[model samples]
Target: MMNLQKKKLYTLLALVALFVILFICNMLLSPYHMRIINLVGINIALVVSLNLTNGFCGVFSLGHAGFMAVGAYVAAILSLPLVKKAIILPELPKWLGSVELSFLPSLIIGGLVAAICALIIGYPVLRLRGHYLAVATLGFLVVIQVVITQLQDFTRGARGINGLTQYTNTWWVWIFTCITIYVVWRIINSAYGRGMMAIREDDLAAEAMGVNLTKYRLLAFCVGAFFAGIGGALWAHLITVVTPLSFSYDRTFSLVVMSVIGGMSSITGGVVGASLMTLVPELLRNLEVGITVGGISIPPLYGISQIVLSVVLIIVIIVRPKGIVGSREFSWNLFKKKKWNTMNQMEN
Candidate 1:
């Protein structure tokens, strides 16, 4: 028990340290680069949230982008300046046209709206397990896309909504990322999270052991949707635009790739995966080849980075199926002990 308490304390301190370092980096980085960091942070929230259902709960869900769209649209409608809407969307409802909120409140409202939608959808869809659930959720994604495309008055139809305020920055991103990581880590280490793992291991056994499978599964689904909603709102505010096509299968693929590459069961894996995937392509864009050893001047293809990453992910899965970190977490105990040893050696 005492050892468990020490472990918990050490984990908390490590998380604190990680946040401090991320905050400092955000403050020191240039605005342009900070935007990329913000993307990394948002993706971290998304991938980690998805892992709750897909990783810990062992449920395959491919429709997270639908929740994101719901949040983005809700937040966009609520947060758009009244004057801007008046000029752009004059035909909007009187209530929508009259109200405008700041960034933070808009994000919260968006998340809440998405959570409500998740509750409605999860109640019915969560009843289906495994492949049936995946197909149903995919259907939901298609339905959402169709609805968004058809909603001309509100969502601006196929042309999409524009002229949003870009209020998202490094500070906001890091703050939300910290909150997400803390909340998820705490939940996963709690009884509820443990019950989720039990269900994942064996639903029948878990049910026999008094674990409420349906309730816990639905809870994890809702929580995942909630964070995905927040990520969507942040993304919308950052880009200052919204298009139904943005949350399509391509987006879903990217999220899946990040989660799988990072390690499905590890939160730190998700963070690393998102960061590397998001930045690698951008970094590749700047690479230049001056000379070729074989007397052939070859410039890198624009999409080579993605192809390489795909190959790497495939190899990782085939060779080491458990992912780079497996279920291990980022903790301070290792670092603290190393530091203590180094100090003792120096003193001696």
Candidate 2:
């Protein structure tokens, strides 16, 4: 027990030190690069949330972008200054235009609204299984985009909401990313998580074993939506814009790709997947600008990022469909196990 406690303490200290180093780097890095760090954190939150539903519960939900849209709009509206709101949303209601909120409160409100939406949507949609659920959830995404386009007074129609404050710095994003990871990790290790896995294995058998399928499934969906909403709010604040197009099917597909590449069953995979996917596009940006080597100029390649990512994804699917991490977790307990074995051998 003492050794375990010591190990935990050391692990916590190491994590704090790592964060401190990263924070220093963030402060010193160029703004363009700093943005990438912020993006990495946001993507981690989004991927982990989606993993909770599709990965753990086997729900195949594809409407995460819709939930994110809800949070982004709500949080952006709440945080916008009264003057900016008046300027941007001239047709908005007087009450909405006049109100303003700080970042944390507005973000919470956005997440809560998304969770409520999931609760309502999940009741009916969760009844379906397999591809049917995927189609129903996808329909939700389409509905959200249409509503945003039509709600001119609230959303400024297709123009989108802009000039949002940059409240999503590395510190804020990193804090929330840690919180998201911790919460999801706790949920995955709990008895409820086991029940979710059981359902994924065989819903009928799980039901026979007295696992309330609806209750557990709804819980996973709502929790996933809640985090996805927060991620959306962070993204809006980070980029200072929220358009209906930003939350389209393509955005959801990107997230699904990240989760798939990371291995949905592993939380570490979410982090790993989000990091690699986010960086790959930026790293490939140079390919778009052409390169010169040994007095030879290579012409710029258009849309090379997409092609490269697609090829990489196809290869992964063909070679290792389970993803980079699959369902396994990385552990530091190897040292502990070795020590215990040595003690037992000595005693014997």
Candidate 3:
């Protein structure tokens, strides 16, 4: 017990130290670097949230982008200055046009609205399994995007809502990222999570074993939606815009790729995948710009990031089908096991 407590203490201290260093670095780094890190943190929230449904719960949902869109629009509208709201959404109802909120409240309200949306959508859609469910959820995404485009009074149509306050910083991103990781990790480690995993493994078997399929699946779906919404709100504040284009199929695909590459079943994998996905495009920016070496300039490699991502994804699917980490969660036990093995080898 004492050893476990000590381990927890050590982990907590290490995380605190790491955050301190990261905060310091954020202050020191260029705006580009800060933006990248902030993006990574937002992706972490997104990847883990999606991981809850698709990975742990074994639900194939393609509507993450849609939920995010809901959150982003709601939060942006609430947080937009009243004067700017009139200018941007002149057609909005008097009640909505006059309303303005602080950042945190807007963010929370956005997430809640998304959760409500999930509840409404989950009733009919959660019954389907496999590709059917996937298609259905994807349809929801399309429908939401279309609605946003049509509702010029509410969403400003294709033009979207801009001039949003930059309420998202590295601190906000990482704070939410940590909360997402903690919440999802705890839920996955709980008995209800075990039930969800059982459903994933075999829904019929899980049902036969007395696991309530509808209840648990809805729980996971709604929870996942809630966090996705929060992530969307964070992203909206970061970008200072809420366009339908921002939450398109491409965005959904990116989240899917992050979850898959990181090992959807593992929280640590979510972080790893999100970090890699966020960093890779930035790291490859030179490819998008001409590279000059030895007085010879090479033409820019447009779309190279996509090509690299595809190639890497294909390789991972072929070689490590379960992902970089599979279903295994990272632990200090790995180090302990290694030390024990080393001692045994020396004794031998």
Best by lDDT: 2
Query: Model 3 clash pairs?
Result: none
Ranking by TM-score: 3, 2, 1
lDDT of 2 by residue, 1-348 (tens): 236566677769967996998778877899999899889999999998899899989999999999999999999999999889888998888787888999999999999999999999999999999999999999999998999999999999799999999998888898899899879877877878888989999999999999999999999999999998999999999999999998999889999999999888778778888999999999998889999999999899989988998999999878879778787654444455543221111110
TM-score of 1: 0.87
TM-scores of the candidates in the order shown:
0.87, 0.93, 0.94
Q: What local distance difference test score does each model get? A: 0.80, 0.88, 0.88
Clashes of 3: 0
How well does model 2 score by local distance difference test? 0.88
| Root-mean-square deviation of candidate 2 | 4.3
Each candidate: RMSD to true structure? 5.5, 4.3, 4.3
Off by over 4 Å in 3: 292-299, 339-348
Task: Name model 1 segments beyond 4 Å from true.
Answer: 1-29, 288-300, 336-348
